[model samples]
Target: MIKQTFTSLAFLCFALITFNVNAQDFKDLDKSPMDAASFPTSNRVTEKVVKVIYSRPQLKGRMVESLTPHGKVWRTGANEATSITFYKDVTFGSTPVKAGTYSLFTIPGEKEWTFIINSDVDVWGAYSYNKNNDVARATGTVTEGNKSLEVFSIAFDKDGAMHLGWGTVRVSVPIK
Candidate 1:
């Protein structure tokens, strides 16, 4: 029991130190900080077969296209590269991907956004992103969100289209 208590106290001290160091890095930001999110796109069976994990970045009055850029490659989500996992082999946007996890990236465009599923699952932002590691690519058109979103969101439609929305823009890519 004493050992467990000591370990817990050590963990708490580490957490506090890490929080203090990271908080100083973002002190200039007035609001709309970056955050993480996760969800499953399918409810098909007892076990969940599809999942997405990503960081949500707030728009903070910035244009989505301006923030993400029109042609530059993006990590799709903030902080770490957005990742999606498939519990079973499934076709995504005309490409067959085996059951595994992959980093989700994109190139935002005015009319359409090019989506990418890459073999690199662990990465930060898009600093280390490489096109050679891309496993699949698909193009999806952009649409208006139902309402302006202050925080970026990634959700799956009932039909299995993964919807990515921020500001007034929304993009849907089919995952089957």
Candidate 2:
């Protein structure tokens, strides 16, 4: 019993010391923080039709076009590719998509943006984006927002339209 007690005490002391040493390394915060957007748009609502998880990247004195770029597939957010989960089958823009989780990708254009719901999940970025894994593709109108946003954001409006905004650029797609 004495030997076991000493071993336990020593292990506890080592764990506490190791944890104290490692705690200092976690001082920095993620530059691009993760955020979520759900349909219903209210905390009071228990049920949700859709939800999106993504990281918000700040502009920080950078141009939106230069960061996202036109005619290229963007991850839709920073870090891991943006993921959207649907509770039920719904019409996304003009395309029908089943209830499931998917990685959201975007191809930005001058007048419109092509939003792709891909079966690929847990992707780091658009680097491994595959066209064959696309579940559905939809087009969203690109417009200029009245106010500029420093960080990339996503929200669902009251009309069930998903909006993506960053800098002065806004893109909208209807979901029903």
Candidate 3:
């Protein structure tokens, strides 16, 4: 009876430690900031566009499949699923993306990545993803990263170009 009790206690301790570790990971993400205005929020030289500036540190370590699963929609970021509001129609990899806000998600693969622009916004996560509302889909070639990225993030260049990159692969999406 004593042996069984000790084993149960050990198991409980291990579970608690594991839960705490995961909780800490999420806490670190929560501490990250979301500053949308500091970054270039507009590109008037070409056409008026609603620029989206976002960054999330948690995207670094979290496994895409474990946290966001395959064949599902993701809210791009933690709080609001990083959103981009466009004032004019734009093209995303040959697909005509209309003027509006869209949630971006990616289906990651070993060699290729499918970038999805979904109409749904304000979602909690990929749990409620709907494929029928996808506005555009683009395929980007993946390149190996020199170092593994713990968090996935995106940034725009000073020239008003979109860059989707992590680890080592950096895909550029020019604004027209």
Model 2 scores worst on lDDT over the 10 consecutive residues at: 19-28
Q: Tens-digit lDDT track for model 1 on 59-116?
A: 7777887879999999887888888888788778999889899998999999999999
Q: Specify the highest-TM-score model's number.
A: 2
Candidate 2 structure quality by residue, lDDT tens digits, 1-176: 99999999999999999998998787679999999999999999979999999999999999999998899999998999999999999999889999999999999988999999999999999999999999988999899999999999999999789999999999989999
User: Which rank order by lDDT, best down to worst?
Assistant: 2, 1, 3
User: Least accurate stretch of 10 residues (summed lDDT) in model 1?
Assistant: 35-44
lDDT of 1 at 176: 83
Winning candidate number (lDDT):
2
Q: All models: lDDT?
A: 0.82, 0.95, 0.64
Arranged by TM-score, best first = 2, 1, 3
> What TM-score, computed on C-alpha atoms, does each candidate reach?
0.76, 0.88, 0.61
